[model samples]
Target: MLGKAWQFARRHKTKIAAVSAITGGLVLAGKLAESKFKQWQEEETRKMLEQIKKQHHYENTEKTSNETLKSLFPALIKTIEKSLDSEPILERIKNQTGNKIELWNELKVLSFARALAMIITGTQLVLLLKLQLNILSGILYIKQPSQVLSSRLQERFMALSQNFISFSVPKICEQIREKMIQLLALSLKEKFTITQLEAFFQTTLLQLDLPGFQKLIIAPDGDHISQPLNPDEHLLLDDLINNIVELLEHEDYAKIFRIGLQTSLSNVFDYLAESYLSHESYKENGLRSEVRLPVAKLIPILNQSITVYQSVLHALIKHYTIREYSANIYESFCQAPPDAIAKPSLSTLWPF
Candidate 1:
C-alpha cells in the first residue's frame, strides 16, 4: 500500500502544481475586482458631494441677493443719514474761502436738498415696491402658457406703470408740494437758524423708516384692502409676495435691479445738486440763512426731479418682467429636476 501511494504522489505532482496555480490566480482576481469596485464607489461619492456643494453655493447666492433686495430701502436710508450728517455739512461751510455770512444761507438750501432727497427716494422705493406687488397679483392666478403669460404680464406691468406716472405721480407730488410749503413757511416764520434747520432736517430724514412704510403698504390688515377683493385674491396677494420675492432672488434680476435703482437715485441726486448750484438766487446770496426760502419754486424743482426717475423705474420694470426675461427664471426652476419640483414645500412658481 505504501509503495502504491508513493507512486501515485509522484504521478500527480504536475496536476497538483497546476491546480495550486489556478487557485492562487482566482484569489488575486477576486481581490482586484473588489479593489476596482471600491475605487468606482469612491469616485461616485466624490462626484455626488461636489454636486451637492455646487447646489448649496447656488442657493446661498440667490438667498443673499434676495435679502439684499429686501433690505435695499433701509440701506439707502442709512446711506442718506450718513451723507447728510450735520458735521460734514458744517465742515464744508468751515472749509469755504467765501464770506461766512453768505455761506450760512447755503445751509438752508443744503438742508432742503437733503430733505427732498430723502422724501423722493423714499417715495420711489415705496412706489416701485407697490408696482411690483400689483403686477404680481395680476399674474399670480393666471393659467396660461409661459410665453403668453409673460407677454400679458409685461403688458399689465407696463400699463400699471403708465397709470402710475400719469395719475399717481402728480397726485402724490401735490401732497408732497403742499407738505413742503407748510414746512418751509413754518421754518421761515420761526426764523430757523442754520444750525436749527440742520437739526430739524436730520431728525426728520432719519425718522423715515422705509420698512415700516413697506409693511403698511403690503400688510393684510393694512390700508391696501380698501377694495373688496375675493378670498382667493387675498390669498393670491400673499402668495404673490413670496413669488415676486423669489423671482428677485434670481442673480441676473437682482444685479440689474440694484444697478438700475442705484443709478436712478444717483441721477436724482445729481440733478438736485446742479439745480441748486445753478439757481440765480443761490448763486447770488449763497444760501443765506436770513434769506426767505423760495418754497414754491423749490417744490416744483423737487417734483420734476422725482418725475424724471419714473422713466428709469419704467425701464427697469420692463426689462425684467417681460416674457423673454421671465422665461429664463422659469427655466432655472426647471433645472431642479421633476422629483424636486414635486415636493410640496419646494413647489413654487417663481416668475415675475
Candidate 2:
C-alpha cells in the first residue's frame, strides 16, 4: 500500500514536493503558534497566581511574629501519649509560599523518593539481617572455621560457578567480537555492499569446478555435458549449486551466525554445566584447593608457552637466517639517510 502511494507520489513528484513543502510550512507555523500560545499561557498563569496572592493578603501574613509562631505551632504540636488531632495550618503555610499546589507536589515527590531509597537499601532491616547472619554463622560453624560451607554447599557453589561461566560465554564472545570488530575497523575497509559482494562471489564462481559437477547432473540415457549445461532441446537448466551459493552469499551471514551462536550456546550452556558437575575432579575431595590452583596450573602453561616460543625463535634463526637478515637490515640502516632511511633487500630480478 505504501509502495503504491510512494510510486504515485514519485510519478507526480513536482506536485507532491510542493504539497510536502506546504505541509511542512503549516506544521512549522503550528509549532511556532503553539510555542507562542504556551508563553502567553505561562504569562497569564503567573499573573493569575499573583492576583490570587494579592487577593488572599499573603503579604500581611508574612509579617507574623516569631513569638506568634512559637505560641501557635507549639499549641498545635501533638504528643504521642495524647490522641493526636493536630494538623498544619494550611492557610498560614499557603500564605508563606503563595503556591499551595506546588508546595504539596514538591513534598509528595520528596517523600516518595526518600521512601523508595529506604526500601531499596533495606535501611530499616539492617539490624534484623545482622542478627540473622550471626545466627546462621553460629549454626553453620561456631567451632570450625574452614567448614563454613558444607559438601552440599560446595556442590552448589561449583554448579553456580559453572552455570555462571557457561551462560556468560555468549556475552563474553559478543564483547570479544565487538572489540575485534573495533580493531578490524582500523585495518579492514567496511565496504560490504551487496553489489561488491556479488561481484566477488561471481569471480569466485568462475574459479570453481562447476563443469565437473554439471556432468553428474546429466541424464544417464544419452546426454553428456556437451555445452556443460545445454541439455536436450537446448532446455538449459540453471546451475542449481551456483544458484544456491549465490542465494547463500546474498544472505546476512554475519547476522545469521551471531544469532546461531547465541541459540546454540543457550542449549550448550546446560550441557556444559552438567558435564562440569559430573567431572571426576569435582567429585573428589578438597574442591576448594583445586579451584584455588589456577595460578599453579597457569604457571606450567606459561612456562610451556615460553619454551615453545623460545624453540620457535631458535628454529626461525636456524632455518630463515633471521639473525643474518637482521645484520643486513642494520647495515642497510647504517648506510642510509639518518632521518628517512630506506630498507634494502635482495632484488629478485637482479639478485647476483
Candidate 3:
C-alpha cells in the first residue's frame, strides 16, 4: 500500500504542490486584508475625534469672546459704582490736601479752571441723568412691558430706580470729570512753561466758545471746531468765575457745593419721575405686592447712561482743546524755549 501511494504521489506531485501553494497564498492575503482594514478604521476614528474637538474649542472661544464684550459696559458701570462715591472722593481730597484750610489755599487759584469744569459737568450730568431715566422708563413701560417683565414689575422698578440714579449720578459725574482732567493733561503735545501757561490761560480763558461747546456735546457727529468767545459771554464767564472764586473763599464751600449738587440731582430726578413713572395703571387700586428687581435688568439702563455720558464728556474735552485753537498755545510753548542751563528745574505741565 505504501509503495502504491508513493508512486501516486510522485505521479501528481506538481499538481499537489500547486494546490498547497494556492491555499497558503489565500490565507496570507486574508490576514493582510484584515490588518489593512484595522489601520484604515483607526485613521478614520482619529480624524473624526480630532474634528469634533476642534469644533468644540472654536465654539467655546467664540462664546467666551461674546460674553466678554457683553460684560465690558456693565463692568465699567460697576467700576464707577465702586470707585466714585461722594465719601471716597471727599476722603481722597482730604487725604491729599489735609485740612480744609490747606485745601482752600491749594485750590484758591486752581479752582477757577476746575470751577468752570464743575459747572459744565454738573449741568451735563443733570441732562444725562434725565435722558437716561427717560430711556430706562421707556424700556420698562413700552418696549419690554409685558414680555420678560410685567407692567406691575415695571412700576416697582421705577420706584426703586431713583435710589440707583441718586446714588450713581453724582459718582458718575465725578468719575467723568476726573477722566476729563486726565485726558486733557495727556493729550497735550508738551509741558508748558509757567510764562507760556499763564499766557495761554489768559488768552483762552474768556474765549471759550459756548455755542461750539454745546454743539459738540449734543451733536451725534463729533465736530471739534475751535470757537472763540464773544465780548459779552467773556464778561459773563468772568463774572461766573469770580462768583465761584468768592464762593470758594467761604469756609463751607465744600458743603455748599455738595448741597447744590444734591439739589440739582434731586430736581432732575423729580422732573423725570413725574414725567415717566406716573403711569395711569400704577394709580389703580389693587393689592400691592412687592416686586423684586434683578440686577441684570438694571445694568442695561446704567450702561446706556454711561455710554452717552462718556461720549459727551469726550466730545466736550476735545472741543475744549481742539488742535486748531491749541496750536497757538503749542507754538508759543515750543518757540525759543527756555535754556536748560539757566532753569535747572523741570518745567511743569500743570500750573497748580
The candidate maximizing TM-score is 1
State the displacement of the C-alpha of residue 49, model 2, in Å, after optimal TM-score superposition. 69
RMSD of 2: 41.8
Backbone clashes counted, model 3:
0
Quote model 1's TM-score.
0.34
Point out the worst 10-residue segment of candidate 3 by lDDT.
Answer: 340-349
What TM-score number comes out for model 3? 0.24
**Model 2, span 38-62: residue lDDT tens:** 9999999998986565434322322
For residues 1-352, write the lDDT of model 1, one tens digit per residue. Answer: 9999989989998998899999999999999999999999999999899667645544443343334334454454444444433345467666876666444444444445444554544444433444353333223223232522344333333233233333343343333334444454342224333334345544544443423322322222322223454464445344444544454444544444444445555555455555556656657878744443343344335434434444443443344333234333333443433321211122333333
Q: Whole-model Cα lDDT per candidate? A: 0.45, 0.30, 0.36
TM-score of each: 0.34, 0.16, 0.24
Which has the better TM-score: candidate 1, or candidate 3?
A: 1
Model with the higher lDDT, candidate 1 or 3: 1
Lowest lDDT sum, 10 consecutive residues, model 2, at 77-86
- All candidates: CA RMSD in angstroms? 13.8, 41.8, 27.7
Q: What's the best-to-worst order under lDDT? A: 1, 3, 2
Off by over 4 Å in 3: 73-352
